[model samples]
Target: MTVFSVNHVTTYAYAEPVRLGEHRMMLRPRDSNDQRLLEASLAIDPPPKTLRWIHDVFDNCVAVATFSGETRELRVENRITLEHTPFEGDEFLLDDSARFYPFAYDAEETPDLARSIERHSPDPSGELDRWVRHFLHPGRPTETGELLMTLNYAIKEGFYYERRVEKGTQSALETLARRRGSCRDFATLMMEAARALGFAARFVSGYLYVPDCDGENRHLGGGSTHAWLQIYLPGSGWVEFDPTNGIVGNRDLIRVAVAREARQAIPLYGSYFADNATASTMDVEVRVRQSPSCELPSAPHRNL
Candidate 1:
């Protein structure tokens, strides 16, 4: 088990003072068998009149903040410490029934995964279908794990990784045609491709831990929030695939939220009201570093 500390800060500056609306924040990390939250704290500038926490439809923890006054600048900072157990790609063991491609999910599990398995984008030209089919051989059973790993690595090697400051992700088709996109775009493409192959997939938003070893950085899309996708396997459950970095499992990925669409898992979003004022600038910084030890304080913040 490795301990990690994450710090995320977002600042929005306006040309003039504006009344802020209720802001929804999805900055808290999920506690799972592989990940355990140890401590968490959140601080906002121009404090909100009220702040409350609730779980969304997907059971992701969200913070709702309502402001009563106006401010020219709004800043949100979140800090968290957790223990993460990495899962290597080769460690994934598929059930015998699901070891090969072209397999169907259990009838009992189909209902809940139906929505995820349904393709969301319209591929009138069948470009994505053709692209995803290249990984399989005609009239031959393909190893499911190998197929997925190859596809994941293909994205990283085939597409150009560009950093975009945009707010939303581009369509899978767009990314394919351009042959270049941000991490989220790659994730969307992978998710849609998996869905087309009759697999349940979801978008994951989180932070990436880029370790500095021997004065060298080891990962991409670090120093900011990252995006990836998860495919549901029978015995393996939801297996993570980060096409952006060609990572097959969780590794240094720290998940904050999961959703069918990227927009639903935005880390922070809100609106401001002002007749003449407009958002002048928006800045975000994320840091994920390994802690020296796994020690904890006497009392931990369980609600975070």
Candidate 2:
């Protein structure tokens, strides 16, 4: 088990004071059997009139804040400390029924996993389908785990990692054509491709702990909110795959939220009232590091 500290700060600047609408934030880590939430806090500038926290459909902690006044700049900062138990894929035992390629989920589990198995978009172009089939040769039998691991490494090796400053994610087809994308695009591509091959997968939005392997091997999508995906194997359950870093299982991935699609797992979702011509810009900075070395600031009270 390893402990880590994560700080994420987002600031929005407007030309003039703007009335902030309700802001729903997914910044807290999701505690599970392998994870323990030690302490978490959120601090916002120009305190909102009312603030409440609730769990969303995916059971992620969502902080909803409403402001009664306008401000020129809005800042939302979050600090968390948690212990993440390392997960070794080798330790998981797959049921005999699902040990081979092209395996099927038991009838009892199919109904509940149907939504994840269905692709978010139809692969009319068949571009993604062809890409995924490359792993399984026409006449050769493939190991289920091997096929999935190969697919994970294939994306990391085949595509270029580009930092996109734009809002929203690119389509899987777009990423394939360009052979370049941010972490989210890569995750979406892998997720959709897995679904096309009859695997149940979902989008994951979280933090990545990147320790320097070497200066030349610096990881991408570390100092900001990162995106990845998880595939549910019949016996192993939901296993994480980070094509961005060619990482299998949880390893250095700190999951904050998971959803059926990328859009649903967005870290920050909100709006502000301003003139049609009003121009604004948003800046986000996230830092994740091993614990005890960095000191964290005091967090604001949960109540406004």
Question: Best TM-score goes to which candidate?
Answer: 1
Cα lDDT tens digits, model 2, 1-304, are: 7788889999999998788999999999878987788999999987989999999988988999999878888899999999987763335567877767788988999998999999897679798899889888578767777788888889999999988878899888888889999999999999999998899999999998877534443467877899999999976889888998887777778999999988998888788897655778989998888765533222121100
Every model's TM-score: 0.94, 0.93
For candidate 2, which ten residues in a row score worst on lDDT? 295-304
lDDT of 1 by residue, 1-304 (tens): 7899999999999998899999999999989998999999999999999999999999999999999878999999999999998763335667899989989999999999998999999999899999999999789888898888888989999999999987788999999999999999999999999988989999999999887655666677988899999999998899889999888777788999999989999999998899884756899999888878333222211100
Residue-level lDDT for 231 in candidate 2: 92
Worst 10 residues of 1 by lDDT: 295-304
- Which numbered prediction scores highest in lDDT against the true structure? 1
lDDT of 2: 0.85
Kindly state the number of residue pairs that clash in model 2. Answer: 0
Clashes of each: 0, 0
Q: Tell me, what's the RMSD of every candidate?
A: 5.6, 6.6
Q: Show pairs that collide, candidate 2.
A: none
Model 2 stretches with alpha carbons more than 4 Å out: 89-91, 213-217, 292-304
